[model samples]
Target chain A: MSSKISNALRWIGFTSLEPLLKLIRGEEPKKNGLLVFKKLLVPILSVFIFLGVCNAGAKYLYNIERERKIENTRSVQGEEAAQQMADCIDSGDISCKPNSLPSPADVWSGAKTLVEDHKMITADKKEFKEKTAAINKKRKKQGKSPIEYTGRPSFVDQIITSLKTVFAGFLLAALIAIPAGIVLGLSETLRSGLNWVIQIFKPVSPVVWLLLVSMVIKTILANADMDKSFVISFISVGLCSMWATLVNTSMGVSSVDKDYLNVSKVLRLGVLSNVFKVVLPASVPLIFTGLRITLSVAWMVLIAIELLAQSPGLGSFVWEEFQNGSSDSNAKIIVAMFVIGGIGFLLDRIMMFVQKMVSFDSKA
Target chain B: MESVIEKKTMLECKDIKKAYPTPKGDFVVLEDFQLQVKEEEFISIIGHSGCGKSTLLTMVAGLNDITAGDILLDGTAIAGAGPDRAVVFQSPSLFPWMTALDNVLLGVKQVFPHATKKQREDICKYYLNKVGLGDAFHKKANDLSQGMKQRVGIARAFALKPKVLLLDEPFGMLDSMTRVELQDVLIDVWSKEKITAIMVTHDVDEAIFLSDRVIMMTGGPYAKVGDIAHIGLERPRERHAVLEHPDFYKYRQHLLTFLDH
Candidate 1:
């Protein structure tokens, strides 16, 4: 219940902050309300009018294209189904009952069957209309269409799930990365040794890691007589992604000032409190830098892993659409690409926001 | 001033000697350097460029070992660097990540471990304000100018409430005006805190201005305190007027001739 007030306060804070920010930016306030609207009128109206016209134009074109495709598909399937049913009746095949009408599966099969029958084709308006009418009647009564059972996740659902996974995984990685980086960064031997490991693995391709892990998981499952491919993929990709975080953490630790170390010694601050208060605050800039780099790496790797392994992620959604070879697939792929790029851009921006928040007061 | 005058002698260094092992045999910086500081005495050691005045101060601060004799604080020999003897180093040795208040609090909290959190905070703020850095207390040490940073360092050292405050050319890098201002501030704080302070510098006027007794060391290989001038100038002495005093100029010229050797 308190969340309601908090949300209201948050909204108010933002609303009130707008004018203050405008003041800081030195924007002059309108003496009369009409002047504000007058200043905004041209750009706002032009943008809305352009958007409205584009949206209307797009909707009209889409409706026309959809109607054409729907007409084409219905006629094509209806003629094929009718021809097959007639042939079956002539042959006294009782299972091919044309009077009862065909299922979508049967209609689809019939379309393939009647692909060779060329006489009752397009340009024959009466035949096409009659066929479409039969298909529509069948669809209304029979409760099925002649579309296939495509095993693809819906684009919107895929987006939500992928976003959830990325955030959860990135958070987990960060939680693990900070402490681990501190430990590695503080120890000289660990820093050097780990740096060597990073040098070897950081630049190696994510696709290569995905392929190797997939093959390894396949071999392991075959040997164990168990199928646990998901766990293996996550482990492989997680490790590949964690490298940036680990290296960055170590770097942060290594770069703490000599005077701070002396201060800690002189003050006799206990290790736990010292690490939390002094070391952590001092190393934040580098830590966030690492997190940013690692986050991007993890995202890129997750997509590559999903695409290569056919895992249930955004990558798989895009791949499945491209593989389907439908006329709509190219447009869907374009939409999916935009969605992927937007999500990545948003993730990096979030990291940048966090960096700003953490490092803001450090300057004085 | 009453408290400082009434304070007892807290530390004394007796006939201390320090030598470094070199290929050409032992090179001595100071030999039989005897200094007995009463409680709250403002003492300055001035000498030639490499006369090991800093080395002498460090040994007394327990940062370095004395070869011959020992340093005693209230009749006990100093073993190592401790809270009772805080040193303000030449360089601004503040933790860059910590704010001025936090840097001061580092020493306060450590020395008075049983003090309440609010008490420590107040103490830190009080000392920082005493050093005229009340406004810059929240600023990070690194962001401060060199003079301001040194003030923070001085605040940190004095917050320890040390029996012996050792300074190794604390204002060496500052400009003349800043150096004079800090010297006055140092004098004011010393008069108030009454902590026994031993500052090492090459500035002749600084020694005459600040110290109760100015110990001038001769040039090293084996330098010793060649002359000890008792600066009998009155309290609240003006620098220009004091320089024109017959006795002040006499002491300065005597030290200049002695240092020429």
Candidate 2:
């Protein structure tokens, strides 16, 4: 039972828990206790200390700003001006207002409000569907299209949309890069021929890629009435992120053990079987490493692409809040920052799980 | 000896030459190398390092292109590596990802695609058991010891049922005990199958114990066979008996003399 728990923890990326579980089972508790202290207890204590420091620092800054505002009012006018400054500060109407860095409590409240807003939008969507059902039935009977909901997308909807776009872009990149990488890996002449082109395009920025993609897509999709921003953003993401996978895959393929190649030759395996059985399997670990890097790059570039294209995503949300400059906008932006970071971390873990699945090397 | 020569000629290397282009100019490694083997004869090529014995074996396996001349198997010129010629490299060279059974099965299935999966698996299991790797059939190559890995390599090569077997210092990496154990296993399999075999080695004792005829090569820059010593020991020779044989020292001295020059 203890071994089972250890294995489960290892599989879930919580290998630090194994020592604790072992200690619970009374299997070398002293050693495991030391491991637990180092891996778990110390880190937890450090996080608490950090949060405490942040809390105290934020309060100290808030008091200093309030005192400064009151002193400035006293110097400019008389007791009336000072009293008004104190009142404005108490009411949270100082000039600095909500533009200051948000405290942890503010971010917490901001996340709560976003969740509530998501729930309200979901309820509104349900109501809209019910109301449109009757009209849609009549319109369908008359061979007319039903009306679509044109309300602003909620925060949750934008997160889902961004995820969908990144996946589409990543899939496109893999589709093009993996096969091209294999071919370049197999043929020396081809690799040399295309090396310059790859080198030139690999370092191009995501913003530049977006501009070029938009210009080309605009010309090609001139008459098509579609979500041009969505298409443009995803294509740009794919272009900017594909280089890592391509370069890594080629290197992996080229460096496959020469003996394995001899084994294939001695067995007289056909070209296609040789690739699938030998080349692909041998290079899978490196290829997956490449894929992980590509996914992270895609996520990093996605926000810039979305902001420039004005697409509906967390990037646009942050940009919009920055422009809005209201009392709560700073807190909301902080919340979005945490959400984006959390999603990036989750994407990386998912890729690691996939890498483990495809590779035979247990060390990975 | 007369009866042995009466048997059919199985393989031949005629006027073989190999050279590499270095910055210094043409660096010749082997020149005018030639040999012939009768059917089912076990021939071991013994030489010091840089003697081009491995280059000769690789040419027969069709892995390396000869700069001049040709190699023939069963009266037909061979070109390029194929299932007809299987090689066991010095290192095990088994795919680290595959199990011992699966490594052998890969060769069996590839060479005999017309056979059913069960038949191919049985062939693989049979060879694996013959090499004393029955218990390690499911173990990955990486998990196996150096000796066990080489056994799997032998199983893989033998499973293909190739017309000719090539061994490039197959037991060079093992300790002495494992080396003797594997050499016995190899002899048992070779005696049962009677396939034409060529092994290149630097071990003088190994060459004498395993081969019907030991060919000693001169040192490089362009090395050639300096002498061929025939072992007339009877069939089913035991390792201890071969070591104690009267003619053993004579053949050893002849090989040592040729190598020293």
Candidate 3:
């Protein structure tokens, strides 16, 4: 049972848990305890340390801004104006509050508020759906469309939307890049012919891709009944992020071992079979390396694309909070920042796990 | 009855040459090579390194382009690599991601495309078992040892049921112990299948031990057949018996003398 758990942990690329499993198995408790401290507890302690530093930093900045504001009021107006500003700041009035980095507690409170807001919005949506169900049923009987939910998306809703967009973009990227990469890999002439194009386009920013996609998509979808922003955002994300997978795939395919190709040849394998059996399997390690990079790049660039396209995702959510500039807005943005980073880390770990599973000889 | 009917020519290399263009001029590896391999022949080409023995074998396998002349298999000019001619390279070259069975099955599937799935699987399992990999059938090629990988390589080649088997020093990378062991495995399979084979080797003992005819090549800059020694050992030759044969030293002396030149 212990060995089985260890294997499972290793398979999922979670070696950090192995030490704890060993501890549970009652072998080398001191060694395992030390490992647990280094692996799990140290990282946890570091996170607390980081939060403490952030709390101190936020307080220092807040006081600095408050003092600057009061000094400015005294210089521009009078002593009375400065004292009034100080009182308003202490009272936590929005207009007089210092716009500074939010402490950990503020971010926590911001997360709670978003969750509460999501719950209330979900209830409202449920009520709306229930209220409109009968009328929609009548409308459907008369060959009419049912009522659609057009309410403002909550933070959680925005996160889901972001995930959907990133996935769509990733799929589009893999679809376009893999075939193109294979073609490029197969023919040296084609690879050299298109090298310049790949090189020039690879580092182009997501913002530019978003603009380019928007221009073409808007014109094409002008008369079409489609979510133009969503289409544009995803297309831009795919284009902006596909280069890593493209380059890696081509490199991988081209670098397939000559000996494996000999095996393919001796088998009298057709081109498709040769590629599927020999070339692709040999190239998969590098291709997955490329794909992992592609996914991370897609996730990284998606926010910019979403923001530029005005798509309903985290980008838009953060943009709205920034524009609102309320006392809690800084806290909300901090929450969104951590959420984005945490999601990106999770996505990378998932891809790493997948890469490990399909590797040539895992646990060999 | 004509004796020509009994002794059919399975492969012919007519004035074959291999050369590469270099900064100074053409660097010729082999030139004016002429040979005929009778059906079911076990021929070993042995020489010092860089004598283009491997180049010749690859040309027969249709992997390398013939810059001059042509190679014919069964009266048809061999084109690009085909299942009719199977090759076991210097290294196993088994697809690392696949199981040993799958590696063998890959070729079996291609060669016997019309065969039933069960038949093809049976063919793979049979060969893998022959190579003593019955227990390691499901083991990934990457996890297999050097000897085991070469065993799979041997299994894969034999499983194709090729008219001709080209072994480019199939056991060249193995340790001496594994090499000798695989030598027996190879000969046993080769003799059982009754397929004509041509092997390139620098190991003189291996050449003598495995071949009906050991064709020695002169050192390079356009190497050709330097000498040939026929091992007149008895059928289904055992290693100990062949090694102890009175004429074994004579044949061994003859090969070493040619290599020395």
Candidate 2 off by > 4 Å = A52-79, A90-98, B135-139, B257-261
Residue range A50-94, candidate 2, lDDT tens digits: 878877876787687678777877998978989987887788664
Order the numbered candidates by TM-score, best leading: 3, 2, 1
- On TM-score, who's better, 2 or 3? 3
- The per-residue C-alpha lDDT of model 1 at residue B16 equals 77
**What clash count goes with each model?**
1, 0, 0
lDDT of 2: 0.89
User: Candidate 1 on B1-261: residue-level lDDT in tens?
Assistant: 334446566777788788999999999988877777877678889988888898887777656778998788988987866767788878877866678898888778889989999999999898888889989988987689999999998888889888888888999989989998898788878778878888898888888888888888878867787888888887666778887889888878877887777
List model 1 lDDT by residue over A168-218, tens digit each: 556667777777789887788877766776788777787777777777777
* RMSD (Å) per prediction: 14.1, 2.5, 2.5
Error of 2 at A42 (Å): 2.6
Which lDDT tens digits does candidate 2 get at residues B1-261?
457447788899899899989999988989998899988899999888888999898888878889998899989999799878889999898888889998898889888899999999999999999999889889988899999999999988888998889999999999999999999999999889988999999999889889999998888878887989998888787899999998999988888888888
- On TM-score, the candidate that comes out on top is 3
For all candidates in order, the CA lDDT equals 0.72, 0.89, 0.90
| TM-scores of all candidate predictions against the true structure | 0.63, 0.93, 0.94
Q: Candidate 3 residues B1-261, lDDT tens each? A: 223557789999999999988999999999988888989989999999988999899888988998899899999998898889899999889899999989899888888889999999999999988988889989988898999999999998899899999999887888999999999998888778889999999898898888889998889979988888988776698899988998888999999998888
Error of 2 at A25 (Å): 2.5
Best of the candidates, lDDT: 3
